[model samples]
Target: MLPKPIPPQPGQESVWDYPRPPRLERTAKRLRVVFAGTTIAETTQGWRVLETSHPPVYYFPPADILPDVLVATPRTSYCEWKGMAQYHSVRVGQRIAPDAAWSYPRPTPPFAPIAGYVAFYAAAMDACYVDDELVVPQPGGFYGGWITKDIVGPFKGVPGSWGW
Candidate 1:
């Protein structure tokens, strides 16, 4: 059975209210990812993907990321709504997080805005900030959503939520 939806507080958004197939929207909020005492990516022009039962996944423009941080991996995954995704490892100084980021190089038509954009897993980075607030990594290693104060969820990535 599907989990019951949580009612969002004022100023908060419930994941249940997000669309089923996911939607990409431009965001002006500051997004930053830090690792190994280095700022790997930062942007005010990121895009966010919102889907039912998940928190928003922010995708930063390639130009905003520091050069040489992302190294492509042989890993790949398929998303029903976004098409094939290519995995990337993040290396900052001597610290390396394998397959910690991903991008859809040739996304499905509806998700083309995210093409060549990179989304990092919050858990893999030392810190991820949305605006001025630190974000919580979405539950489960496989889903790369970032949870913030304004987002409410009985999220899909939690344990025993595989059927969701």
Candidate 2:
């Protein structure tokens, strides 16, 4: 499925565009991200990853994850579309991944659908796989744009992309 409100009247080539669907697209692309020390959070709503800028932050249902040991942090960030997002640190035995996980406690009007879903940074994760095959991490550090084999060279993850 897709999100609602539709996309800009069409024809507009803005970076912040979405193909809203009535329901969330529960793709077969579901994968697991294991951090060095993060625990997944199982919620009634589900696992939602809250991050912003350009791409729509990916949210995974709680039942879809195995959050055995992650620690919540006081860190937070604001997004124009979503709202305020909380942070978490995962601890697997002795190692710990700081702010490896994030969620939106209170989202704005448009993105209330993804209240508790969580998404882990592909770069911070030890490994992410869709069933059997491992997925490549999207190039940017701050942005989680996973790099797949099909993706050609030259990817940008900045605010004002100059020549990207």
Error of 2 at 11 (Å): 22
TM-score versus the correct structure, for each prediction: 0.99, 0.63
lDDT of each: 0.96, 0.53
State the displacement of the C-alpha of residue 109, model 1, in Å, after optimal TM-score superposition. 0.6
Model 1 weakest lDDT span, ten residues long: 155-164
TM-score of 2: 0.63
Judged by whole-model lDDT over C-alpha atoms, candidate 1 comes out at 0.96
For model 1, give the RMSD to the true fold.
Answer: 0.6
The sequence of per-residue lDDT tens digits that candidate 2 reaches over residues 93-121 is 78777888777777776667667667667
Query: Model 1: per-residue lDDT, tens digit, 58-132?
Result: 999999999999999999999999999999999988899999999999999999999999999999999999997
Best by lDDT: 1
